[model samples]
Target: MTAEQINDKIELCESAMDLILSEGSFTIAQLSEATGKTASQIYSLFPNKKAITEYYYPSLVIRYSAMIGEIEDFESYTISEKLSNFIFTTFDMMEDRREFVEDTFEKMVFKKGCNSEFHQEMTALFKHFFTTDGRIAVSAGFVMKDYFYEFIAREYLDIVKFWLNDDSDGKERSFALTDKLTGFVEEVVYNKVIDKGFDLAKYLISHAGLAKNIPLFGEWITSWFNDNEEENKDE
Candidate 1:
């Protein structure tokens, strides 16, 4: 990429954020001002504000994934702590770009549910967490599916909404509640399965206990039970 291309990209993003927050729309002139770049330079990088927004979603996903990857790397940290810290770090990353992050998160969580790209990424991460640190937990018997997302969203909706509204409280409640619920899940998953060594997976497989229709917009919802031998490998 040209130096102007490389340089203006960040500015375009910052400007888009500032304009959206200050005014409800992101414009070329606003982005140019925010990034201290000439209009011609910006035009060369981005055709228009809509292009910036389009790029923002995928870029946001990549950035968010990296943040979650950090939480995943902390082997000593419990799942609950990692989750809490993840939420905190996430908000921090979106400090000035709060509106976009909140809107994207809410849309993925409640509106479109898991149909959105963000939710798909999150579900993949959760699946990875289970196969890794949570492997024993899963093998032992913690087979709850859809309820997990519902539980998390329900647990933090108000705090998240409040934080989006003002963010003056520094997201204290959101942090605390996320930590608490994650702890609860950790206990339910770890203590119940790892410590006790319950054969819940067997029951789940033999009986299809965790079966439910996953919400797919136009596609058939499928369940990923431990017994599905075909789904044992990566997709």
Candidate 2:
């Protein structure tokens, strides 16, 4: 969608969320009134209440992207800092709509599974800042080849779950949780931890002789190991 269309949808979603919170249910007419837009206008963006909520978390990602996109120096942030900005800004975005999130949590997560889209999109956004992995993928290999970003997306949802339960003052503990986790992950992933894990996995797989049984995943692992070694040789 064009940026304008996305923004209109986001506004409509915001109206739906507020209406849901205050009135305990949402309808197209209600959203139209809330947004000061006609029912047809609202329909054009969000056909139904479910679509609005479905777009909620993903919209937050876009909001973060837009927010950071404004900062003149955001591109200069370190990998960890970029991650921190993303996570912290997301929390801030949800803080005002915490009730909407709490009420819709099970529906959005358990039902629709937002992580598949949210984190993958966020990973693509991070692609702009996490240039090391991108560069490696171009020359050496795909450092985060397959399910790597998917795993990060899962981890992010786990963290969001943790944040929701956080009762500390302004969620100070959870913010600290984000900071510590991202710092550690950046140091590890950007520091060849994946390659190290590959070496260990290759050793284990060799000793176990899984080469005869499991073909797909085992070969994926072996292929990445081989590719990384080839890149090192070139270096």
* TM per prediction: 0.55, 0.73
Clash-forming residue pairs, model 2: none
lDDT of 1: 0.56
Residue 182, model 1: Cα distance from true site in angstroms? 1.1
Candidate 1: list runs displaced more than 4 Å.
Answer: 1-14, 22-24, 28-61, 67-73, 99-109, 138-159, 165-170, 193-235
> How many residue pairs clash (N, CA or C atoms closer than 3 angstroms) in each of the candidate models, in the order given?
0, 0
Q: Which ten residues in a row have the lowest lDDT in candidate 1?
A: 213-222
The sequence of per-residue lDDT tens digits that candidate 1 reaches over residues 5-34 is 544575577668667877888667667667
